[model samples]
Target: MSCSSSGNEAFMPDDIKEKIHNHPCYSEGAHHHYARIHVAVAPACNIQCNYCNRKYDCSNESRPGVTSERLSPEEAAKKVLLVGGEVQRMSVLGIAGPGDALANPGKTFETFGLVRQFAPDLKLCLSTNGLELATYIDEMVEHNIDHITVTINSVDESGEIGSQIYPWIFYNNKRIYGKEAAQILLERQLEGMKKCVEKGILIKANSVLIPGINDKHLPEVSKKLKEIGVFLHNIMPILSEPEFGTRFALDGVPSATDQQQMEVQEACGMDMKLMQHCRQCRADAVGLIGEDRGAEFTKDTFAGLSFDELQIKYDLEARQAAQAKIEEFRFFLDQANERVRKEKEELSSDGHTILVAVTTAGEGMINQHFGSVREFLIYEAGDKGIRFIHHRKVEAEYCAGPDGTNPLQPILDRLKDIKLILTAKIGGCPQGDLAAAGIVADQSYAYQPIEASVLKATRKYFNLPEEMEVN
Candidate 1:
C-alpha cells in the first residue's frame, strides 16, 4: 500500500489513476470481470455495419433482432434481479439490435428507467452507431446513463453509401441517404461526444478494426477521442465467421490481427485493448452480473428468468416458480469449478494445491496498483476456482517524500498462506524478505501479459499458460 521513494511518481496515486483511466484494466477496477447485460430493446438499428449480420455472437454470422423472445422493461428488470448479485461489477442494458437505439426512445429510455429503479448501483451502458445520439443526449444524461459506446466506421463519406458501402446521415430529423450523410453524422458524432463530456458523461469509443478501409484512420480517431476526454478505446476487430467473414466485407475486411491492433493502439497513443473475452453480446444479452464478456464468462447471467428458458413463457414470477432451473445452474457451476480445478492441476497446480502464479517487477513496485486504484482485474479467471492475491505495484511516493516504511505492509499483513512468488526480477531487500516469508521466488515470462520492460525492473506479473497440462 505504501508507494514512496525513488521514481516517486510511482508512489503518486494520481498517476496510476491516469494509467487506469486510459487503460482497460482500470475499467474493471478490483474485479476480473465487468458484468454487462445487452437488452434487445429496440430490435433495430438506424445504420448498418458491413461486417455485421445483426446476430448474437455474430462475427457477421449471428442474427440480429432475434425475434422469438423479447422482454418488456418490467420483465427485463426481473432478469436483472436474478443476475445482479452474481457479479462484482454490473452494466445494465445495451441496445444492440436492428435499429438505432435512440430511434426507439420510448422503449429505450423506459427500459433503462426500469433497470435504474431495480439496480440503481449498476453501471449503466449502451452502444450505438451515433445516428440518433444528439437527439437523446438530454434523456441519456437525465437517466444518469453514461458509459456509452459509439461505433464509428469512417468520417469520410463518398457517395449515397450506395450498396454495402454507403455513408448516410440523420440530420434535421431525417435520414438523409448519401455520402454527405456520413459526413454530417461524423460531425454529429463529434458534437455528441463533446456534449456528453461537458455533461460529465463517461464515454468509451468502440472502433471496429476494419482492415483496409478505416485502419489508417485510427490515429486520427484516437486524437479526436482523446481530445474529448474519452475514457478508453476498444478497437474491436471485425469478427469473422467462416461463412460470411469475407463475403460482404470490404475487399479486405478480415479480422484485424493482434499485431495490427497493437500497432494502432501504440500509434494513437491510446490504450487500445485486444478485448480477450469480448462476446459481443446481442443488444439484449445478459452477461455475468459484473464480469467481462471478453473473458468468455457467461454463466448465470439471464435476460429472462431461468425458468422462462429462452424467454418468458409466463410472467417472471410465474416462470421463476420453477426453482429447479436455479438448482440446475448451481450444479453446472459446480461442474465448471471442478473442470477448471482439474485444468489448473495439470497446468498451474503443483500438487493437491493449485499454484496461483503471480509475476512481479524487480523494484517491488507492482503492489501499488492493488490499493483500490482500479476497477477491473488483469486476470479474468473465476474467483471460485482459485485463490490468488498480490500486492504487485508498490506505490512510490512522489514530491520527495520519505518512502516512510512500505505501505505494502498492511496488505502483506493480510495474506494468510501465500505459497510462491514468481518474478522476472526483484531487488535484494525485497527478495530476502519474500524468501524469509516462505514464498519460493522464481523467474518467468513465458506467456505473461504485463509489459515486459516493467516486469523486468518494476516486477510486472502475468500467469496465462500457453498450454493446459493434461494429466
Candidate 2:
C-alpha cells in the first residue's frame, strides 16, 4: 500500500495492528485520536552531533534535545500516572531524551519499570541514538517495549558523510573522532536495528536531512532500512536556527527548506513507509503530536502526591472505556475519509493538485482560529488524496488592530504558495490580505476533519462537484 493513502490498517498484520492501532507515532491515522508523552529522565548522551545541543529550561523550542526539566524515575512514574489520568487519550509512554535514552541506561529502565508497575496499561517505548542498543534488545523485549525509534542518518561504509554530522562519540571508555567514530556509530546502529527487528520489535528509522552532506545519501539509507524489515522511515529536516545554539547554526550551515525535505521524503518513500506527521518533538513533550502541555504537570505539581492517590486517578477501567468510544468514532471517521479519497481520485483526472494550509489545535481537525494559530499544517489535496506535506510555523499569533506593521503580511509571505486556507474563523483584514496574494481563505468547513475538509474545499475552489458525503 502507498504510504500516502489514508487508513493503512488494512495492510497491517493482526498482531501489529493491536500494537499500533492507538500509537500516534507509529500509525498516522491514530494520531488524531491518541496522544503520547515523552519523559526527560535520561539526560546523558555519548555522541556529539552538529545538529544537536541538548538544553534544559528551554520551553520555547519545540525540537528534539530540549526539555524544561529532568526528572527522576520516581517523579517520572508519578507524572505518567497523573498525565494518563488527565489526558485519557494518552496511550504511549516514551523516554525520548533531552539526551540519549540508552546512554543513561540505569535511569531509563528504572523510569520504565516504575511506569510499568504503576500504569501497566499504557504502552512503553523509547528513542535512542542506537550506540548502546545492541546491549539492551533483550532488556527492552523483557520490558514489553515493542516500538523503537533510531536516528540513522548515514549508511555509507566509508563514513565520509557521517563524519560531517557527528564529530566525536564516547564509546568503551574512549572518545573516538572523525571517520573512525562515524564508522563505529554506523556499525553499531545497523547492528542494533537488525537485532531488534529479528526479535519482532518494530523499528522506526529517523534520518536528519543535512542538505549538502546527506541529502542524496538518504535513499541508500532507506534501502538499507527496508532490507532489514524496518517498519517506517521518517526523514526530518535539519533545524539550524541561530538561537538554538547548535554547532550547525553556529557554523552558518543553512537549514533544510520544505522543498528539500519533500524531495528527500519522495526519494526515500519509494523504499518503505514514510512517517510524515512527526513534529520533531521535544524530549519532554506532552499531549498530541502538534500540541505540548508539559508545563501543566511540572515536578512541583505532583510533589507530595502518593501512589494510592495516583492509582485512584489512573482508573484503568474508565480509561479503557473511553478508548473504546474513541475507537468507535475512528471507525466512522475512516469510512467517511475513504469516500473522500475516492472523490479525490476522480477529481485528479486532470492531473492538477493544489496546496492547502490548515489551522488546527490538533485532534486531526480544523479547530484553531486564524488569529490564534501558532502554525499551519500544510497538505496537498487531489490525486493522492489529502497528504500531509509539512508544517509552516508562524512567528507570532496574529493580533488585530493597527498597532505596528501588519501581522498578516508576514503570515501571507509564509503561505505564498498555498491556494486555500482552512481555518475556524478569520477576520476581514487577513482575508483581504490573503485575497491580494491570490489565496482563498474559507471557514465553511470550520471544526471539521482536516483531510476531508481539504479535499472538499479543494473541489469547491475549482468548481468541482462534491460527489460524496464526508460526514
Clashing pairs in 2: none
Q: Scored by CA lDDT, what does every candidate get?
A: 0.47, 0.87
Off by over 4 Å in 1: 1-31, 56-69, 85-93, 157-175, 242-247, 250-252, 270-279, 288-471
Per residue, candidate 2 scores C-alpha lDDT tens digits across 1-471 of: 344423455767899888888999988878878998999999999999999999999999999999998999999999999999999999999999989999999999999998999898989999999999999998899899999999999999998999999999999999999999999999999899999999999998899999999999999998999998988889999999999899999999988987788788878867777887888999999998888999999998787899889988989888999999998888777765664543324436577988899998876778999999988988877743566666877777888424678788778767878999999999998898889889999999888777788888887887877544334
- Lowest summed lDDT window (length 10), candidate 2: 338-347
Q: lDDT per residue, candidate 1, 1-471, as tens digits?
A: 100001122233673443332122223221222345565557656654567654434422233333224556666555555554443234344665545677678887888887676555555666777767777899998897766777765555442332234334445666676656666667778778788888767666777666766777766776677777765555656655455543445345566654565456445543232222233445554444222232232323453244334223222343333333433543443343333321222322334332233442211113222222211112212212232212222223112223666543543433324444444454565556656766544444422433221223121223433333446
The whole-model C-alpha lDDT of candidate 1 against the native structure comes to 0.47
Error of 1 at 459 (Å): 8.5
Model 2 stretches astray by more than 4 angstroms: 5-7, 342-347, 400-403, 468-471
